[model samples]
Target: MELESYRYIAIDGPIGAGKTSLAKRLASLWDAQVVLEQPEENPFLADFYRNAGQHAFQTQVFFLLQRIRQLQAPLDPALLEGRFVADFMLEKDMLFAGLTLAGEELALYETLYLQLRPQARLPDLVIHLQAAPEILQARIAERGVAIEEGISLDYLQRLSECYSQFFYHYEGAPVLTVNTEHLDPAHNDADLRTLLQHIEEMRGKRAFLNQGG
Candidate 1:
């Protein structure tokens, strides 16, 4: 599939794995619009990171609603106009909900998710970026976002596992999984060009790009 042939592209990964940066770079190269998740806009995120048990429901609900609105509004326009690259997949809401919510809270989240999920437009191609937990931790530390200061390696490991499981059975779109431990497409021109070539050459429902070892 050529890069231009994909109208909707979604790039997903665990936190600090650089999905957003790569999405932005790809969008620029393709002259595509970007639909990104703005964690900073979530008022409960910092608190949720500090005390997940206390603020988990609030944080999850806020993100769910925000994602739905973004998908319906800005993303809809871009999809109709031309190509767009998003940093998130709509199913990512459930991934986080499962990680944070429990018991009745989880049940309630599922109910809301079922109601809003059908409204989302599925992506034509999903780019699932992977990296070692240590690499993710280093990137997180280097970025130094205040809310992410409390992120633990254990949490990142679990998140990475969740992402892997989610994409393993993902059937809504063709998936291109790229190991990013040694690949830096966001800043390296050679890496970006190589990745674009790989995207152009993709001809299967599922593929792997393992430059990391």
Candidate 2:
């Protein structure tokens, strides 16, 4: 299948994995609508990063509701009339919930999630970006987002593990797992072309793409 064949595409990974950058590049290449997660818009994000135990629930809930609103509209003929690309997956909200919430908080979160989850639209294809935690941390530091400065290596490791576990059992969409530790598609034309070719050639329910490293 080619980039044009997929109606909805999602690029997902742990923080600092460059999913958003790649998503934007792919959207430009495919002339698709872009849907991005606005972490800066979340009032509790900085606080949550600084003190997860105290602010986890609020931050998670905010993101959950925001994503629900962002993706509620299905990919139908009435929308943009072309493929759409997003930086995050709707169901991954539960992965973060599992990592952050516990006891009564988790119970309440699960209830709310179950109620709102049905309205989400699944993607036609998912591109799962993977990188080592140290590499992710380096990239995070390079980007220098102030709130994200509170993100620890341990937290990134755990999140990367969570993403791996989630996608291992995922069957909702065709998945393309790309090892991006040594790939810089955003800056390298060759890397971008290679990834685009991989997307164009994908024909299985699951595929893997790794280049340069």
Candidate 3:
């Protein structure tokens, strides 16, 4: 696929899947502007992790509102001039909202979400990062966020399954699902280069690049 045709390339995945780092690298390589999600901005994340049932709705709302606000800004001229690499896609927030929010909360969330849906810029390609739960757990541990210490493997597995189900039917843009279990884009130049090749050559609705496979 010609890189010229793509104005935005988004890297998406669950936590610890290296979306941020890879987004940075891809942006640097392609001279694309980077739009990264700021998780720290969500004050409810730590509490949500400790007691999901109690703080889930607040956490989800914070993220939803924050994302909408961020996207509400005019599209950066740099991003419009060149390709853009983003660590998060607005639609992916629904994956977490669906998993964590309950009946009344979810209904409220959906209403607000629909209202803000048009604010997001649709990407030309999305890189859906994937990894085994064990890999995800280890990476999260390595990050050493005190809040994530309470996150359970079962929760990560459920999140992974939810992502799989979402991308399975996603047809909005070309998607490249990569198994990033053993591939470290941070330290492995080979892995990064391989992904770059895919980003440069891919044109299909969906593709997979599993270095582990």
Candidate 4:
């Protein structure tokens, strides 16, 4: 399928995978409306990173509510010929909850997720970014978001694995898995063009982008 043919595109990946940057760039390039996670707005995020046991529930709940609000609105028909691009897909929130929460907390989170998830719509296309944990860690450190200072390599490794597993079985939308280990679409215009070209050239429901064209 061609890139512009997709009216809604969602980008998914583990933290530090550069999904947000790519989402923003694609939205801008296509003149599309962008829906992002807005992680900075989550008050419990920093605390959760520092003290996951004490703060995981609050952080996850905050994201669930906030993201549902963002996802509930139907794509604006009034907007010009453009797409809606979001940095996250709703179900992956469960991935984090599963990783961090357990027992009653997890059960409660699942219950709430089931209730709120009906509002979210699947995107026509999903761009799933992939990168080694070491690369992700380096990018995270270079970007130097203070709240991310607490991110651990081990956590990133686990998150990357979870992302890989999640997308492997994902059937909600056509997914394009792009390995970013050798591509810097976030910062390099050439690399971004390479990705966009691959996106447009895609001919299957599932394709992988490894080396640039």
Pitting candidate 2 against candidate 4, the one with the higher lDDT is 2
Model 3 CA RMSD to the hidden true structure, in angstroms: 1.9
As for lDDT, the candidate ahead, 2 or 3, is: 2
| Structure candidate 3, residue pairs in collision | 1-201
125-194 in candidate 2: lDDT tens per residue?
9999999999999999999999899999999999999999999999999999988888888678998888
lDDT for each residue of candidate 3 in 1-213, tens digit (9 for 90 to 100): 877787888889888899999888878877877778888888888888888999998898888888776655525443366677788888987889899987889999888888877545688888899999988999999999887888889899999999999999998899999988867765689887787788788867988888744
Q: Rank the candidates by lDDT, best first.
A: 2, 1, 4, 3
Q: What is the C-alpha RMSD of each candidate to the true structure, in Å?
A: 1.5, 1.5, 1.9, 2.1
Models sorted by TM-score, best on top: 1, 2, 3, 4
Tens digit of per-residue lDDT, candidate 1, span 18-128: 899998998888888898899999999898888889999999999988878877864554446778889998888899899988999999999999987655567889999
Poorest stretch of ten by lDDT in candidate 3: 71-80
| All candidates: TM-score | 0.95, 0.95, 0.93, 0.92
Can you give the lDDT of residue 120 in candidate 3? 52
lDDT of 4 by residue, 1-213 (tens): 777588899999988778889988988888888988899999999998888899999999999999888877744454424689899988898999999999999999999999877544578889999888998899899999999999998889999898888888888888889888888787899889988888788776788888743
Quote the lDDT for 60 in model 4. 97
Q: Record all residue pairs in model 4 with backbone atoms less than 3 Å apart, i.e. clashing.
A: none
lDDT winner, 1 or 2: 2
What is the TM-score of candidate 2? 0.95
